[model samples]
Target chain A: AAGVIQSPRHLIKEKRETATLKCYPIPRHDTVYWYQQGPGQDPQFLISFYEKMQSDKGSIPDRFSAQQFSDYHSELNMSSLELGDSALYFCASSPMGTRADTQYFGPGTRLTVL
Target chain B: DQQVKQNSPSLSVQEGRISILNCDYTNSMFDYFLWYKKYPAEGPTFLISISSIKDKNEDGRFTVFLNKSAKHLSLHIVPSQPGDSAVYFCAAVTSYGKLTFGQGTILTVHP
Candidate 1:
């Protein structure tokens, strides 16, 4: 079975609207990371959550935020979406506090902001 | 600025031939390096990795060599198969769990 799972394989939102994306980490894993992939580019780290806390955040705009619940499921929220926000979002997970290496990814969610 | 870089935008290889993908990084603090393979509409899949402590790591047909002093790493796929055709991304792990990725190289294997 695939390790990580992301919801809403595709999403479309209007400019200034809020978009919520969800992700479920692999069972028993404690670290979850989010990344954004723009067209013809490599994936960019967005944020990481471990032990129900924000472990690290990338140089993303303040309009983007993430939350991890007790169950290890995480949610990425984008407020006031812009056309530039159109991209593929990936969720990955690894074992707790383990070296930030060997992360398993899920099929991403393609977001199109109009 | 792109901390990690994969200069080659694309490469084509004949089936059963060796495919070498190179990556360089400007960050000296990156202790772990990894390569990922991705197909269209899919997230990147972990391929191989090498820690800063080790110069090389191999698994089956894939091998990753890391040179800490030069801040360079390369992935070699022996006897590449058609199924191996995908976009390969090189990444480096720094201070936190954040990973810096390179603009991927698309590899096409012709049978």
Candidate 2:
């Protein structure tokens, strides 16, 4: 079974710069979710999309934006990157249905803002 | 305020013994509960989940029990092996698929 795919398994950026992270969800999955896990902390929900539409939002920062493309893949855009933004970014996908709640996660992208 | 909490930070079990991890939630609206196992530098792997309608769900060597009235859930791993050592996270979801995770509990099964 194909799992979710994330680009740039590891990233290093400087403060005040910009970065974009991409996620290719499992084939045929309709919903994509983004989460951030800070050092020593649990994963926090950032945002989610269903059918390419923004479905829910969580603690995502105002400087960050995300969208799901027609291909069911999603991208998270961050600007004016801050050192605090450094964390593990994860993407998860699920099919639309009663079992859609069960999300399959991708190996996270480790973002290090220098 | 943390809606989901795993009070224990770590647990140790002898191989072949049973390991139990507990989680508590304050949100009454949460209807679905899930447990995930995570290794360092990797994404969480889904273990088992139990819906509010079901009191218990079992798989292979893992089982999840839900007590709706107590707003508590627990994951049980029987015949624990050293390979099972890792972090376990408890997550809850309402009608929406958005997950609220609990601080993970590290479990070490000694061989």
Candidate 3:
């Protein structure tokens, strides 16, 4: 089965710079979720979308924004990046209806802010 | 405030023994609970889940028990093997598919 796909498995950026991460959810999956895992910490919910529409929000920072495209893929854009933003960014997907709560995660994108 | 908590940071068990990991949650609104197993440098893999209406769920060698009244859940791995060594996380969901995760517990199964 095809799993969620994330771009730039590893990313390096400098302070005050901008970065964009992309995610391609599993085929037919209509819900996309973003999470961040800091060093020595568990994954934290950032945001989520359903069928290209904003569905729920979490602890995402003001400097970060995300949107799901018509193709069911999503992008997370971070501006004025800070060193503290360095962490493993994960994208997960799930089908709607009965299996909506069952999310399958991608490998994750490791962001390193220098 | 932290909604989910896994008090034990680590657990060591001999191979072929049963491994039990516990989790507690403060939010009563959470209606669904799941257990995820994660290896280093990898994303969390869903192991098993239990609905609020169900007291337990089992899959192969893994089982999840829910104590709704106590707001607690636990995962049991029978006859644990060395390959089962990994970090286990407990997650809860209320609505909108947002998962609140607990601090993971590292399980070390020694052969």
- Which residue runs of candidate 3 sit more than 4 Å off their true CA positions? none
At residue B2, what lDDT does model 2 achieve? 90
Q: After superposition, how far is residue B51 of candidate 2 from its true place, in Å?
A: 0.6
lDDT of 1: 0.91
RMSD of 2: 0.9
Interface RMSD of 3: 1.4
Full-model lDDT, candidate 3:
0.94
Candidate 3, A65-108: lDDT as tens digits: 99999999999999999999999999999998755346999999
TM-score of 3: 0.98
* TM-score (C-alpha) between model 1 and the true structure: 0.97
What local lDDT does model 1 show for residue A81? 98
What is the C-alpha lDDT profile of model 1 across B1-111, one tens digit per residue?
Answer: 999999999999999999999999998988888899999998888888888999999999999999888889999999999999999999998775677899999999999
lDDT of 1 by residue, A37-87 (tens): 989888998988889999888867899989999999999999999999999
> Chain A TM-score per candidate?
0.95, 0.97, 0.97
DockQ of every candidate: 0.79, 0.71, 0.71
**Whole-model Cα lDDT per candidate?**
0.91, 0.94, 0.94
DockQ-sorted candidate list, best first: 1, 2, 3
